[model samples]
Target: MTTLMEKAHAGVVTSEIKRVAASEEVNAETVRKLLADGFLVIPKNINSKSEPIGIGKLMRTKINANVGTSRDNVDIETEVEKARTAEKYGADTIMDLSTGGDLDLIRRRIMDAVSIPVGSVPIYQAAGESIGNMSSDDMFNAVRKHANDGIDFVTVHAGVTQSSFERLKRSDRILDVVSRGGAFTISWMKHNCMENPFYSEYDYLLEMAREYELTLSLGDGMRPGCINDASDRAKFEEFIILGELVKRAREAGVQTLVEGPGHVPIDEIGLSVTAMKHLTGNAPLYLLGPLVTDIAPGYDHITAAMGGAVAGMHGADFLCMTTPSEHLALPDVADIREGTIVTRIAAHAADLTKEGVREKAREADRRMAVARRELNWNRQFGCAIDSEKAKMIHARSRNADTCSMCGELCSIKMMREVMKK
Candidate 1:
């Protein structure tokens, strides 16, 4: 019944650690040490059977795709397809954020559909069921339900306490709180005139997490909703609380990750990422868009990728994909695929600068370069992250060896002929 952290602490390398180590190209003992030190987290609940992934220092930057139903749209099959698409397109994890339909059924269906780790936000269900009148028991029950349904991780806004709320009240934020779960927690606390149950009863929460071996993703409920609100006191106060919660979770042998900002200006991303890493004692940092700008409504995925690449370079361990439909509407399957691929690109871009995986990342680019030099269309497509797209684009040209852009005037072909002489 020992948790993975507990086993790691005892110097016992579990099969999960071995798998993660092998996947990460690190020694099993190294994975064990990192887990024991709370630097890496493998968020596989005991009841869930999925491929283990390592997220933290020395590991490849990971990407997460969110697929779920909203109040206006409730189709379990569509959400399941989104989950499958996310996994097929290389998402490291899938989070079921359904607020409509049977949340339990939707969550279990997503878990059944994908082999990657699945996560959820329990407060959404708590608020959905009670309409903001949820008691502490209602919140705890939602978390327990998710764990029992084999969700590998759950986002708990344990850091959004009354003190953090007071800080928010005193602060000047443009858009205020943008996180749905955060707003739910705040509304519930205000209605009941009580401290956040998750914060006040953290020990109980940790105990349940240990029992299920579920990873706790400390949700950033006070994350800035706009670039103007970035780096405010409320956000930092919640971060400080999350940092302490992380220490407690580690002490209790529960795996943990700290969620980060919603929106931030481009220049502040590095500081935001490093500050979160430092505050949480290097617990694997999971981040939402941290969207650098608010202007690109139709292309927030691009903006988020830009921010994600910078955040990863600065030590963010995990990224949540932001779809093109962000701030607009619920994303369709195509949007999910596009977002997942773009986020993967961002993660790989950052991995090229990271320590352990830089060489591996560079090898792909090297192969692409060599392929381009030889004008090997097949090989070039093979080296591409989206080979189908590459092949499609290449097929547009009438000439097989050279693309339409340059035809016989291709620079690589010219350079090759000169070099051969």
Candidate 2:
């Protein structure tokens, strides 16, 4: 039962490696080397039939859309619709963070509905089952259940240890902890007066991860909630712990990636990303917003995209889509669609500056530019990230060759006439 990492170390290029290689347009050997070195991760649970995706060095920056039901809004059908809509709109992965209803059924339904890798935060289910009476065994059991259920990846707050908790107490941050999983781990630790089980029993966790070839997304439990709390001592302390854990996971031949900050000032996003990458031995970084500003409750998606583009430029490997309802409410299908497209745009925008994929990303922009210059409305829509949205918006304008804003005063048309003369 060799994991992908083990297989790669053995120099065996498996079908997953080939599929990822073809999708990334990189050599199969390059993918093998990256996987073997623990720089690239292809998260495919053995039981999952989802497509293998390469995330990390030399691969296009990927976006993940999170869809799930909260206790207040437990509509499984809507959740499933959001899952399919996310994939259709260009999400590289889907994470079912359902905390209500039958968690297992919802997770499996979402997995069956999409062809991309699926992830989950096991602690959510553990807490749902045993809010105040959660035992160390309960947490481990949740992890095992998700792995056995074929979740491609799982977010474990192994870094929220007693030591980091002490550091958190020493700090006077505006927002101490914003991550739901992080808060859960801290609450369990405090209530039980014990160390975080995931941290204390990491070896056992590693064994289960290896058994399922599960990619451990070492969750940033101490991620800053607001811009004011960015880069605090507690956050960096947790990062140091996660860095050590990253090495341990790699040594154990288990796939892993490090999750990063939630909210960061625009100027600090790049620095934060670089420090995390260096500290974690350049393991793939999956970022949640690092939302550049604290304002814009309704438009957090735009802020997240702005921050994501910067993070990607600074080598962040994956962006988790932050919907307009980020702080307001759970995202509906429309919000999921918009968020996925926006995040995909941000990922591509960052890809334009990346080394290996820059030219490939630029080619799309080039096509869009050509279409615009020629007043090729159809071609423009074809090149858009959301073709339907582009068409819908364009349909508002009566003119076929130009939009409403520049009906007869269209610059492209005027430029064409002058150039022809």
Candidate 3:
């Protein structure tokens, strides 16, 4: 089975490259080169009906909205709606992290609901029999199942091995492990008295990936759970391992994306990003919030957006949306919408600073600036990321042209008059 990366390396630009090139506004050669070098990835499974999305170098920093059913809350329809809602609100992709209610059905329904690429954590399902009962086969089986179901990418916490576990024990971490998949892998290893199957038998995983043309997302299993635990030895240890795994995957022609730390302070984000990129040879860096702070539980979405923008500026290629209910409960459709839009804003904000795509991103801002300056409400709405919301908020104003905040005292309006002279 020839994978896209292998094809690219062989100097064959497939249709996927052509489509992504047109969408990202880069020439097909650029995408091909980046994919061949393992610096970018297009996570399209052979069976996936979803349109291809290019992630990594020279592409717009993308947003992923996670929709899934919790054990306490299992509504297939709701989960599917959440997926659609996220896509409608500008999420670049969706990850079905469901741990409840007929996982296969929930996963398939979510995929059918959206045209964007879908991703998942296979170990979550493997742990359905409880952590203690999961055999190594269970883990691999779940991965193969999801891949067969057209999961474009899968987050395999292959870094959480016996070696990394030793480092974690040496480190004095407060939250210890916040990643459920990481916790599961560690627990299973401790119980079975063997190394993580994903690591010990990584060649097998790579074989399956190549067979399915799957993109491996090297999960940051030991990622910092809070700012206090940010960039610790354990985290870096995992990065080192993931870096090795990334090279192995590339050699096998299986495209890969490296996931980064979830909770990091604003000051240290650059360091975390740089280290991960360096260690992993700059494989497409997919990041969870890297939420700057842990105290704002309810407004974690905003907290994450603040951190996401900074992380993107520092070379994060993808930002996973965090909702207001992030630290609370299963997010509904409304939460998904809010989170997707907020994360998209952060991605766009970062694009304004990123290379290769900055000028194109800036041109969009220029259009909005001109619209605002001319007080073209309709044009301004047209340029908005969420024109419906913009129009709604603008409709609240007593003045027809300017918004309620400044009204007739609007700076743009005043500036327009000033410029006329």
Candidate 4:
């Protein structure tokens, strides 16, 4: 029952390692070394038939799109469409954060709808019954159920312990907590006057993870909800505990990813990303928006993209997409597609400045530049993030050599004639 990390440590280059190596364009041995050192993780459960996705140092920063059913809106077909749309646009992964209506069925349906690795917050399922009714066993059982159902990874807020709670009480913040899982953990602890089961019984959780080779995503329960609350004591306290848990999970040979903040200002995003990586021993960091500004409701996706680019440049490994409906209501399929494409643009922008993947990232831009110079509209469209949209936009111009704005006065065309003279 050796986990993927254990296999990597044993120097066994399994098929997963090979596939990730080929996809990431890194050597298989290098991938194994990084995984063994806990700097990389491939979130593929033993029962999942989904493709392996590498998230960590040396790999391109990946984007994750969340699709699920809320209590008020439980349309399974729409959720499934959202999942498909997310994947089609460029989401490296999918996380089903559905908190309402036949969760198990919704989860299975979403998983069946896509071939990419899928993750979930098991607490969402466990806390559905009622925070008061949720026992420590119920928490652990929910995790096991998702793993058994072939969830590639699960977000566990194991850092929301009694000690972290003390720090939260001491802080004076605008938004105390914005994470649903975090709130649930705190409420459950308050109800039973007990520590979080995920934190208290982490070893038992590790045992189950090893059995299923589950990649545990340590959720950032105390993540800041606003710019003012950035880098608070409560958040760091949780990171300290998560760092220790990360070391233990590595020892137990379970792959792990550490989640990061939600609404950090643009300036603090760098420090926040750096500190989390340092504290967690460079475990792959999966970040929510860490949105630069809190004011944009309809355009939060763009806000998050700005923050994500900076965070990715600063070493954040994975980004969770923030849709246009982030603060509004349930996102439709169009919202999912736009969010996915926008976040991908951010990820690619980050890769251009990133260390390991900079050359590859720049290569794509170089190709586009060459096509532009040659007035190759088709090639430019081919290189675009949204080829269909690019083609559609250009189709309106009718001038194939130059766009509507510049037309016959295009600099690229003008320069070519000037050079010939």
Clashes of each: 0, 0, 1, 1
Local accuracy by lDDT, each model: 0.93, 0.94, 0.93, 0.94
Q: State the lDDT of candidate 3 residue by residue for 1-421, as single tens digits.
A: 8889999999999999999999999999999999999988999999899899899999999999999998999999999999999999999899999998999999999999999999999999999968998999999999999999999999999999888999999999998899989999999999989999999999999999998889999998898888889999999999999999999999999999999878999999898898889999999999988899999988889989998999899899999999999879989888998999889999999999999889999999999999988889999989999899998978889897778897778988887788895
User: Who is ahead in lDDT, 1 or 2?
Assistant: 2
Candidate 3: residue 56 Cα off by (Å): 0.5
Question: After best superposition, candidate 1 residue 181: deviation in angstroms?
Answer: 0.4
Who is ahead in lDDT, 3 or 4? 4
Poorly placed runs, candidate 1 (over 4 Å): none
Q: Which whole-number lDDT from 0 to 100 does residue 39 have in model 1? A: 98
lDDT of 4 by residue, 1-421 (tens): 8778888999999999999999989999999999999999999999998999899999999999999999999999999999999999999999999998999999999999999999999999988768998878888899999999999999999999999999999999889988999999999998899888899889999999999989999999999998888899999999999999999999999999999989888888889999999999999999987689999999999999999999999999999999999989989899999999999999999999987899999999999999999999999989999999998888889785899988888999999888895
* C-alpha-based local distance difference test score of model 1: 0.93
Runs with alpha carbons beyond 4 Å of true place in candidate 4: none
Provide the TM-score for each candidate, comma-separated: 0.99, 0.98, 0.98, 0.99
